[model samples]
Target: MLEVQSSLDKFKKTTGYWDFMEIGIAAIMIPFFAYQAYRLPSILSKFGAILIAIWLTCVIYTALKLKKAKPHEGDSYIDYLRQCMEYLERHKILSRKLMLWYVFPCLIGVAMIVVGQLDLLDKSWEQIIDTRMVWITLLIFMAIVVFAHQTNKLVVKKEFTPRLKKVGELIRSMEEDQVES
Candidate 1:
């Protein structure tokens, strides 16, 4: 019982910190992206800004919702554990979708930029393709996609999976105790 309470406290603290970080990052990035969109005054810039704004809005809404959440007023700590479990499950799904919204479009835009810059040196497309630069550009484009994917995997593996597992364990432990009663 003592150990369970200790673990619960630790988990709650960790969750609080995670929520803070999410909100903090969104607070910084939303305005930064908005400023970039405003400053550039281009179609691509505006589109990118809109994407970031959407991402930031989703991020802020989820983070703030999680942060402000409370267990039922008269419920026990077991209920709090259940509440946390539900919230974490929702957050995990949202995080994945949010990554798709942000990362995939951004990566595709990078690829498009590579294609767009082909004529920048005032050379014909055939002449440019004949050079080794096209191969190098392709390599860079692929690297961007691969690196972004690996980074997302590492974040989920390192930060999210562990916390989720802990929450699951706590929820089960509490449930088993409740069943025994």
Candidate 2:
């Protein structure tokens, strides 16, 4: 019984740790990308706008799907935590797909920065800064951040909330059982 209690405590701690980490990551990304947007609005182009729109569509779809999901059954607190962790793992995989979408723009942005710094291109400062290439890359990066935020929110809703709910239910059930006994 003591061992079971210890395991439950460990699971609770692990879940809390991951929850904090996710929140921290999301919080950092928001401010970082906001700075990026302000610093490089000129880089945003028509193609990038389309990409952002598509990314937003995916985010909304994923959120709706997760919001509609039903919680799984569990026999113990550890079981519930394990189930939630599995859900989070699935979300991690989905996040990789979103990351893939940003790869092209990221590479292009890096190349542009490097080439601009090295003076490999003969473009003027205004042309380099105001080019469609730069804005599109910025747009892609911003869109990725937005998509990540949405995915993180879904993970919190599907994993943390449900696990917390299960833990509460378990505590209530245990109290009732003890009272009856």
Candidate 3:
């Protein structure tokens, strides 16, 4: 029981840190994106800013939602374990789908910013496509995406999956013990 409590405490601490960090990042990013959209002259820039703002807002919302998964004081061990499992499962799903939720929107937003900047120079579509800026931006985006994806995978594999399994084992053990009682 002490071991289970320790594990739960660790999980809660880790998750609290993660969720708060995400919220912090999103809070900074939302205003930045909103400012860019409000100040930028180009239509594409505005659109890009909007996209980024929306994405970051969703990020904040998700983080806040995860933050609400805390175990109440009166909850039993099984209930607390269940809550932790649900939290882990949600994070696992989010980590697995990082490309969808994290990379793709940012990619589109950055692409728009790059293209819009080029567009402001009175460049034709062909000229814009021919410029090194587009390719470089794309390459940088791809590199970042790959690194983030790999990092998320590693965290899920090393941290989340093991914790989830431990929590599951604890829950089952508790259930069996209860049954025996």
Candidate 4:
């Protein structure tokens, strides 16, 4: 019994530690992406604009999801950690979506870069933007955001959520057993 109790306590502490880390990482991502948007404003190409918009949208969605999450019932450390994992999974899906979104744009960007190197287009940054490379870059960036969001959602829904739910049920059952005893 003592060993079980000690093991449970250790798990709880580990879960709590992980939860804090996940939240911290998510929180940091918002500002980092925002900075990217600000710095890359010149990416007004069609692809660039779309990428920026998508990224901003995902960031907002992530923030909202995090904001709405409530602590799990029973305050079980394991449950709490599971909740955090769910959030992280969602984020991972989003990140994957973002990556997918970037695919086309990146291809276009690469094409443009190659063309520029071959003297097919102006090589200067100003010329690149004028030639529509900005749009291509933007598109790539948006694709990246889409890839991120979708992947995160997938992990959350398929893996983390199910496992977390199972763990939660187990905890609840244990509580019930204790009550009966």
Candidate 5:
């Protein structure tokens, strides 16, 4: 019980951490993306604009998702337990959906940035986007998708589910206590 509570307390900290992490990345990337849009020519400008828009939407979506887990104050023990369960369940649902909204843009941006840099070796941008680069980018994107899915599964199984189950048991016990009284 003590250990469960300890884990719960630690898990609670992550509720805020997600918001901070997301915001920090958004802060860093928004300006950079905007700058890319300003400086890049033609199609790359369009790509940069699309990337910025997607990234902004992702940031907003992620922020809202993380907000669902923020605990409110002044709840009684049973209510607090219930709130925790709701928070964890929200996290579980969001984790499953994260790939679609969060992973694709991130993977695309990362792959483009890395592969784009290869053009520094006197290769033309058009040449850089050749079949080999396409294959490599495709592979990287696939890897990121798998990694994100597995990570989400592992965190939910290891953290959110356990905390949710523990809080639920407490809620049930408290409800029974109230009923007995």
Candidate 6:
């Protein structure tokens, strides 16, 4: 039980740190993305900035959502563990849904920027779009998306999933012990 609590404490701290880092980076980049819209006179640039803004908004929203799962200190042992499990479950759900709420908007925003750049070069679609450059760019970004998704999945599988199971088992056994008493 002490070990489980220690593990949960670590998980909470790590989650809080991650949230802080993500929000901090987003805060810094918000101005940069806003400047991109203002600096680039292209419609695509403005729209791309909007999409990126949406992605950041989603990030903040999700972080806030995760923050709401805080465990109260005064709760009973089994109850506290249950709350910890709830927090981990929330993280698991959010991590699983990153493709919808996290990656897709950013991908579209980046694609818009690439298209805008190609257009600015005054190259026809066939000249630029058909070349190895565009294909390589697409492939690279796709690879990154896959890598990120798989990494998050692995984290949930390795870190959160086992912890969740252990917490659940702890709660169950504690309950059984109580009933036996």
Report how far residue 27 has shifted in candidate 4, in Å: 19
TM-score leader: 6
Tens digit per residue, CA lDDT, model 4, 1-181: 3443344355446545755665566466556545554654234333343454454455445555654663454566555545654544554454455445434544454443345334533367666667665566568667766766676677557644554455556557667777999
- Candidate 5 stretches with Cα past 4 Å from truth are 1-4, 107-130
Runs in model 3 lying further than 4 Å from the true structure: 120-126
List the candidates ranked by lDDT, beginning with the highest.
Answer: 3, 6, 5, 1, 2, 4
lDDT of each: 0.66, 0.52, 0.84, 0.52, 0.71, 0.83
What would the per-residue lDDT of candidate 5 be over residues 67-158, giving only the tens digit for each residue?
86566644576666677677778778877788866777666665555444444345776776664866786786788788888988898788
RMSD of each predicted structure: 4.8, 11.1, 2.1, 8.9, 4.3, 2.0
**TM-scores of all predicted structures:** 0.59, 0.35, 0.89, 0.35, 0.78, 0.91
**101 Cα displacement, candidate 5 (Å):** 1.3
TM-score of 5: 0.78
Which has the higher lDDT value, candidate number 1 or candidate number 4? Answer: 1
- In candidate 1, stretches whose alpha carbon ends up further than 4 angstroms from where it belongs are 1-4, 70-74, 95-98, 105-181
Candidate 4 regions exceeding 4 Å error are 1-129
